[model samples]
Target: MKVFLWNETGKEKEIMLEDDQITVPADKGKYIYEVLAEWKNGEISYTFVAEVQ
Candidate 1:
């Protein structure tokens, strides 16, 4: 499994996962993220938006 994040600047970055968990950015703003999982049989990916106040 892999995780990625994109901020308002449109720059994409990889986020390190600890124990299958991720820590969102501390900055107060909205961000986009993508989670990808792959296996021998098949693979899948999904995107979500997160807002931090």
Candidate 2:
């Protein structure tokens, strides 16, 4: 699985995971997180917003 983190400034990073957990540095604001799941036949992805205070 792969995880993507993006900020308002367009700064982003991609992290590869073996299991299903990852830690990322987040600033106080709104951010987006995208997760991709890879399969043998196909792949799927999902996106959500993260609000840091």
Candidate 3:
């Protein structure tokens, strides 16, 4: 599995996972994220947006 994050400026960055967990950025703003899961038979992807205050 892999995870990535993108800011409003379109800057993409890879997120590191610790024990299947991740820490969101502290800056207050909106962000986009993409998650990819792969298997021997197939693969899947997902995207979503989040807002932080």
Candidate 4:
């Protein structure tokens, strides 16, 4: 699934969601979802969907 992320601190890269988990970079920072209806702002946000395994 596609995840919209905003650089809350105006820094850091938004990671893609995979295997039901959102991968984070080695460095730490803050960010929020660019899309509201699909996501929420928080340390960890998850979106679940069905796909070919």
Candidate 5:
């Protein structure tokens, strides 16, 4: 269940990561593309990609 804190507000501390996904409090389906695009860097970062809904 690896997950990342996909917070739209850009607040890293507001994350609740797990496995394979992120713990976003809001409906991801509404902001998936935006978040992924804003955070995607293809580096060793723990947070790379994430689902919306």
Candidate 6:
């Protein structure tokens, strides 16, 4: 599984992780995050919005 994030005014950035958790440094704005899950069956994508301060 991989997570990607970006603000409404910029391109998406990939979030790297050493474990199940990862940290993202965001500026004050609205951001949208997407999770890409790769499985044996197929690939799945999930999206969510975040407000950063």
Residue pairs in collision within model 5: 1-19, 2-18, 2-19, 2-20, 2-21, 3-18, 3-19, 3-21, 4-22
Write one digit per residue (lDDT tens) for candidate 5, span 1-53: 22234346663443444563455445555323122223355533344554456
Off by over 4 Å in 6: 7-11
True-vs-predicted CA distance for residue 30, candidate 5, Å: 7.2
**Model 2 off-target regions past 4 Å?**
8-11, 16-19, 24-26
In the range 1-53, model 1's lDDT, one tens digit per residue, is 99899766764888899999988878898889999999999999888988899
How do all models score by TM-score?
0.83, 0.68, 0.81, 0.34, 0.23, 0.67
The regions of model 1 sitting more than 4 angstroms off are 7-11
| Best candidate (score: lDDT) | 1
Q: Can you list the residue pairs that collide in candidate 6?
A: none
- lDDT tens digits, residue span 1-53, model 2: 78888767753888666567865546587778888889999999898887778
Model 4, 26-52: lDDT tens digits are 444433543223335534445333222
lDDT by residue for model 3 over 5-38, one digit each (tens)? 9766763888888998767778898778888899
Q: Candidate 5 — what's its lDDT?
A: 0.41
Candidate 4: C-alpha lDDT:
0.45
Query: In model 5, which runs have C-alpha deviations exceeding 4 angstroms?
Result: 1-11, 17-22, 30-44
- Sliding window of 10 residues with minimal summed lDDT for model 1: 6-15
Task: Write the candidate numbers in order of decreasing lDDT.
Answer: 1, 3, 6, 2, 4, 5
Off by over 4 Å in 3: 8-11
Off by over 4 Å in 4: 8-15, 34-53
Cα distance off (Å), candidate 6, residue 43: 1.7
| Residues 1-51 of candidate 6: C-alpha lDDT, one tens digit per residue | 988876666546888876788665566776688888998989998888777
